[model samples]
Target: MSILLYFTIVPLGTAFLVTLLRKKKGISDLLAVLSSLYLFGLSLATAGLTKSHGVMIYKVGGWFPTIGITLVVDGLSAFLLVAINLVAFLVLIYAISYMERYTDKWKFHALFMFMLAGLNGVIISGDLFNLYVFLEIASISAYALVAFGVKPQNLEAAFKYTIMGAVASIFILLGIALLYSYTSTLNMADVAYCLSDKAKNPLLVFIWVLFLAGFGLKAALVPFHAWLPDAHSSAPSPVSAMLSGVVIKTIGIYALMRIFFNVLGVSINLLSVLMASGILSMVVGAFLAIAQNDIKRMLAYSSISQVGYIIFALGVGTPLAILGGLFHLFNHAVFKSLLFLDAGAIEYSTGERNMDKLGGLNNKLPVTGYTSLMAAMSISGIPPLAGFWSKLIIIVAAVEAGYIGYAIVAVLISIVTLVYYLKFQSFVFFGKLDAVYNKIQEVPLAMKTALVILAVICVMGGLMLTGTFRPFLEGASNVILSGTGYKQAVLGAIR
Candidate 1:
């Protein structure tokens, strides 16, 4: 079988096998960690293969397009695979020690692997229905994970998230059904081929609106962002990291990009709407974050703001803008996950999540404090860090695209980002020691190890924009710039 298939299979197989071995002490952790490592290695290998071979297509049962399931690995898919699997591996390692407090650790690992399988599947799916299937898999896993603690707040948050998620899924399915009715094909390439010559009819517009609402909710853009702060804050820290770091990007932003750019093809009207939505998400999310005292809740709000940067950049529709968008996506995955993990560490040590109650922790929990500082600086776009470069690229691209007003909003919102994050730093790490937390120590070795690695990435992620790693971003950008020619590219690859 093709290596690309293993991205989905490995985690799925491990999830089930781990379930069967749940009664064995340490076996579930061993298998789960090993599975994540294998998938991370496979993702790197896929990146190399994609670089060498261009786009690749894996057919199931040797069936042709329109008759069977297919998985496509392009530069974009490879880029996301590397980011997703790398973070998953690190989060799994962190979970090993962090989850010791919870019972049924095996079930957590199983669900986590299941979520990873779903994420990989979504990234590679070549058909609309298949994408939905994987999306649901990931969504279901996430809902379960959100409520895994069974706390009152967790249960309430999970119920709210599930209701909203179900509505979004219905919208997406309705959109898919309408598109299939028009084109009579489930294959994404085939659907694009059929729609290529058609005019922008009301049916097409309706389908586009359905998709925008569905994927926009999944991406947590403002107005559709009601569930995010609650859901992300309520879930376990590692699960929160996965949700914000990769889940929203995978099933939400990635799906939006693939369908709008590659399938329906970008339109001026749609791009305008996207830009408007992004701007609102940026400004509104930042403001909400500023009022939050709960550490995880604030980070959850920050995720909405950061995602806005990506969506706004994409809406600009310039090659430079797209590059900036993709880069920010990667950087956000790194630093945001770092922040969430740090939040977890803080809670793990002191049992306090409210910023007002977490004063002067730096003296007691040096590792979490320092790593949190690095992550906060990066997310605030401090120079020489990964976040600065991507945010700069995006703003520059906006100005170049003649969207100066939007650029101004972005710049101002960036200041808001800095303000809230600094508040977070000051309250959590720099103030006088709260007597209650004076004796709290650093987190476990494994959690500390994950935080350090993610912080290192935050410091070094800018290298992707430099000499050797530049092509990885450029290659992914080129795929999107290919637009509806994606149909031709996929067809050629399969042939």
Candidate 2:
């Protein structure tokens, strides 16, 4: 219970205190930083405990079994905890320096902390309705954070995101209601258990459609991805890192995998649909991105493309394919966040995100230039970098699963990916220096620290595919692999 309460307490506590004294402007940054550090520590402690033992269950208000809202710390939760908290800690470090340009640093930190709480809560929660609650928490904070800049574009993007997100939430809620009505249980595993032997209902297909629509919007997959570029590119950099990095994975793709694989039990038809969409997103996103001059906008389009690879891998549904998909998910989270943060750093220094307006920064903004280069290479699947190994596995798995066409497409996109990245590097950092950026300096220490740490992770994240690190990706994959046994795993672990 302490573990679950930590989520509620830390963010609520921080939010309350921040709101009360935010007007003071004194000691707010210190308090904000301290609160985030503490939350990071808590998540780490939770991770160590889960890795050492097995799942940890906390039932709220003394309710037992399927009757209560339960927070479960199984392999899936633990893996997300590490990824979310790890990125968050680095984002916080970056925010310390990155947020200096924005006013009301305290309020910014407060919103950031609340966002983390919502994300963590969404990951750990075992109850379907509770997941909705946490999803809203994260989404609402995100809506505000996207508009944190209060610029016309920021507000417009935030408005668009809010409307789309609200629609998605309604779809999810309606699906939950249908599930609750059919199974008479709000608990996920319990619903799965009750459904384990139940005859197929036509309602399931309907529910699947609803879920696909909802989470697809959340994940920003191709057709549903229209909102992502505008929103992600408009938000502040640290917020951009968080949104592109963890929020979409936790609230969107992660939930989709959990429900489709574990709870709903997807069919071959479902997988075919998944693979087709993945391929479409991969090709379309990459093609569109190559023409963009807005660096952040380009990255946003690239995100859609990369995320397609994960979905395609998952659609293959092979062990190695799932491994590749999950590996790519984590690897993408690390380097993508670094890229966004680096973008933020450059924007902070020069107040420009237009690639054509900037150049020759390799010398002046060494930290931003090199770190972003590493992230670009990692994302483009350069050898020995994190992106290459996961991508290799995904392509291999696609071939293994007899999707040679998909494999060919994935490979081609890798080349396309490299092309756009080179274009970004050439236009943003390698060409002649822009006269408007002459006096820019390196970002503050805290932001630099964030970039360096994430760059190191980008260099080494491929190690996650290896022996000791295998458990993180593998254990999380097994949770989905054992989708058939999912009901048993959760029901058996009940108090």
Model 2 lDDT-worst window of ten? 24-33
RMSD of each: 0.8, 1.4
Write one digit per residue (lDDT tens) for candidate 2, span 234-341: 999999999999999999989999889988887999999999989988999999999999999999999999989999998999999998998899999999999999
Residue-level lDDT tens digits of model 1 in 370-444: 998998999999999999999999999999999999999999999999999999999999979978776777898
lDDT per model, in order? 0.94, 0.88
Instruction: Report how far residue 471 has shifted in candidate 1, in Å.
Output: 0.7
Clashing pairs in 1: none
**Cα miss at 396, model 2 (Å)?**
0.7
